[model samples]
Target: MSTILTYHYVGDAPADAGSHKSLFVPKHEFESQLRAIKKMGLETVSPEEFHAGLLAKDLKRKVWLTFDDGRLDNYELAFPLLKEAGLKATFFIIADHSLGCEPGYITVPMMKEMLAAGMSIGSHTLTHPHLARIPAEQLAREVAASKQQLEDALGVAVTSFCYPYGNFNAAVQEEVRAAGYLLATATIRDNRNCDADRWQLRRAMVTPGKSRSRFRYMFSSLYHWLHEWKNRKRWKPREEA
Candidate 1:
């Protein structure tokens, strides 16, 4: 099995972040977490490499680092730290928010720089909508059009995708596949095995305010089991009721 870690903003939360402040991890904390991952002797891989490893069944002790939303803070803060650590990650971009269309998101030039530095890019949809709730035609556009836009902008074969808000259904998965993505990531909190579904691959979220020890535990073998156990406990009462 391999571990995939998901992150959002890499700096302190801004005032406009509102209730989603937890998505913003402090810069120092993110740096420390990278160091911890290194200390644990885990090798980080790009999305393409991770997919290759999965196909070869050689994913033991491997980690795939992923960031979503393509926020500007990721380019300003996380990119340098990752470059310093000699680590490469995949950033999922919202096509509509990029290319200077939005103020706080990453632009085409920033994404090009990251790609030039060995980082990978993936499509996060056109506008980051809830795929499970949208109409089929809109879903196709979100999935397929985003891929074309990113590839046209970056000149790279965009093969990876991430579900917006981690919301996807069977239809969404099919749309992603039909759009030509090799793999898609979801917010499912668990480690993934080689046999895991490519369209719904699980990821462990790295959020803010976690202690050093707790952060380190995220890379341990026991984390997934504990996470799932707690989730089952949280939902068991509802199932019974």
Candidate 2:
């Protein structure tokens, strides 16, 4: 069994919470979470490692640590903590927003340092736009441009993604696939996937809450059912209207 842990801001931000809304995970809390993972004995692997060997059907449970958006805080807050724990994470950055955002943004130099220090980088599209709502060509442009920018800056293969706003349809998934992404994390909760969902992977949303529900969820599939029901309902009402 495997679990993907999703995160956003690793450090404090303006309370406004723009860009990635619930993606924010405070620094101290993140450390606490990582410590918990270690203390609990779950082997945390990179997405690539899971692909390689961690996902064997009989393999013990594992986790993947993922961060979204290219915030300066990732470099400032998350990096040191990850280093102290000797753990690595995959950071899905909005390549175009790598710099020149508000008070601060991640620069190529910062990205370079992380890469050198063993962190993996993935794309979150060019402008962080909703790929599902845009025109066909615009969607293609966003995917291609982000992949290119990250490749040029990081000088490594940028292969994974997490859909912006946690909203993507089949067309959007295929577009990202055609653009060369090997894996993508959706905002869906509770369901752990098999090999068929390798490209469109499942990541449990790690909010300020839900960290301690492990034993509860383990005992009850109904807990997972209720969570999925609510999240799916979160999207269905607009269509009915």
Candidate 3:
């Protein structure tokens, strides 16, 4: 089982300190975490690797470092830090909001530059809306349209999807799978997919507030066990059927 490390803003670009979704990691702290990722020997893997691993039952040990919303801070802050570390990551972009070829969350030049610099781009959705309860047509639009948007913008095949807010059900997953996505990541869900449930891969939320010891613990399975036991909050059960 691979632990996918999920992150948000890195540079705190919106510049507001109190935003919860942002979770702005300052440049220095972000660099520290990047160093930690490198020092820990967690080889970064793309979603394509996860998909191929599911098919071949290969477990060579890798971490999928992913960022959601395609935020400006990701391009400004995270990109440089990862570059310095000689690493790369996947960004899931909400497509409809992209104006002038890039959304306010991220700019056009940033996307162009990142692709030019060898980064993988994925689709979040066309509008970043709640998918589980939306109409079928709308859901299809969100799935297919956003992918088309990404491929057109980046000039590469966009095959991964990350659920917005981690909200997705069986039908939603089916929609995304049929829409040509190879892998889909869900928030707050964790497990190694054994071919049957590869679409909804789980991720671990690594926050700036977590201590270095806790960070180290995350590289092991014990981290999830201890976190769940300590909190007593039932995990959204792994897809075992």
Tens digit of per-residue lDDT, candidate 3, span 161-194 = 9989777878889898898899888876343345
lDDT tens per residue, model 2, 1-241: 4567777777655668776555667777788877877777777666567665434553245667788887778889988898788788888888767844444567888878887877888888887887778999988888877888789767888878878877687788888889887777777665455666665676666665445555325324574577667768764563233
* Model 1 residue-pair collision total: 0
Q: How would you encode candidate 1's per-residue C-alpha lDDT over 120-234 as one tens digit per residue?
A: 9999999999988889999999999999999999999998999988788778888898989989998877775554568878788999988989887776779878766775765
Once fitted onto the true fold, the runs of candidate 3 whose alpha carbons sit more than 4 angstroms away are 12-22, 99-103, 189-194, 226-241
Which of 1 and 3 is the better model by TM-score?
1
Every model: Cα RMSD to truth = 2.9, 3.5, 3.2
Off by over 4 Å in 1: 230-241
Q: Candidate 3 clashing pairs?
A: 98-103
TM-score of 3: 0.86
Error of 3 at 198 (Å): 1.6
Let me know the TM-score candidate 1 reaches against the reference structure.
Answer: 0.92
Backbone clashes in model 1, listed as residue pairs: none
> Against the hidden reference, what TM-scores do the models get?
0.92, 0.83, 0.86
- The most accurate candidate by lDDT is 1
Error of 2 at 147 (Å): 1.1
In what order do the candidates fall by lDDT, top score first? 1, 3, 2
Candidates ranked by TM-score:
1, 3, 2
